[model samples]
Target: MITISVTGMTCGCCVNKVRDKVGALPGVTGVDVDLADGKVTIAGITPERTALADAVAAAGFHLAD
Candidate 1:
C-alpha cells in the first residue's frame, strides 16, 4: 500500500470521487480516502505515483508529496 496526500477535497462526494478515480487505475486493488487527514491510501501491484497523480488531477484534485 502507498499513501499520497491530496488537496481540494471537501466532502463525502469529493472523497468518493477521489476513491473511484484512483480505484479504477490500472493495477489498483483498493482505495481509501481520509478526508480529515487529506490523504489517500492505495493498495495494488506496483501502481505508479505519476498515474495516480494524473488520475487525481483529472478528477480536479491535486496530489501532493
Candidate 2:
C-alpha cells in the first residue's frame, strides 16, 4: 500500500472525488480515504509517486509532506 497525506478534502464529495480519480490509476485496486486524518491509502501494485501526485493535483488537492 502507498500512503499519502492529503489536504483540502472536506466532505463526501471530496472523498468520492479522490477515490474515483486515484482509483483509476493503473494497478490501483483499492483506495481508503480517511477524511479526519487527511490520509489516502492506496493499494494494489503501488503506482508511481509522480502519477499519484498528478492525479491528486487534477482532483484539486495535494499530497502533503
Candidate 3:
C-alpha cells in the first residue's frame, strides 16, 4: 500500500473522483479516500510517482507533499 496526501478534497464527490481516477490505473487494485483527512491510500504494484502525481493533478486536485 502506498499513501498519498491529497489537497482540495473537501467532499464526497471529490473523494469519488479521486477514487475513480486513481483506482483505474493499470496496477491499482484498491483505493481508499478520506475526505476528512484529505488522504488517499492506494494498493497496487509499484507505480511511478510522476504518473501518480500527474493523475491526481489531472483529476483537479493537488498531491500533497
Candidate 4:
C-alpha cells in the first residue's frame, strides 16, 4: 500500500470523494481514507505521484507534500 497525507477532509462525504477520485485512477485497486489522520492509503501498483496529486485535487482536496 502507498500512504499519502491529504488536507480538507472532515467527514464521510469528504472521505467518499477522495476514495472515488483516487480509486478511479489506473492501477489503483483500493483506496482507504483516514479522516482523523488525513491519510489516504492506496493499494495495488503505484501510480505516478503527480497523477495521484491530480486525482486528489480534482476531488477538491490537497495532497500534503
- Whichever of 1 and 2 has more TM-score, that candidate is 2
lDDT of 3: 0.87
- lDDT string for model 3 (3-65, tens) is 889999878888888998888888999999988888889997747888888888878999888
Clash pairs for candidate 3: none
- Cα deviation at 23, candidate 4, in Å, is 0.2
Kindly indicate the candidate among 2 and 4 with the higher lDDT: 4
Model 3 CA deviation exceeding 4 Å by range? none
TM, every model: 0.91, 0.95, 0.93, 0.96
- Model 2, poorest ten-residue lDDT window? 45-54
| Best candidate according to lDDT | 4
Each prediction's RMSD over C-alphas, in Å, is 1.0, 0.7, 0.8, 0.6
Among all windows of 10 consecutive residues in model 1, the one with the lowest summed lDDT is 44-53
In model 2, the clashing pairs are: none
Off by over 4 Å in 4: none
Q: Order candidates by lDDT, high to low.
A: 4, 2, 1, 3
Q: For model 4, what is the error of residue 54's alpha carbon versus the real structure, in angstroms, after optimal superposition?
A: 0.5
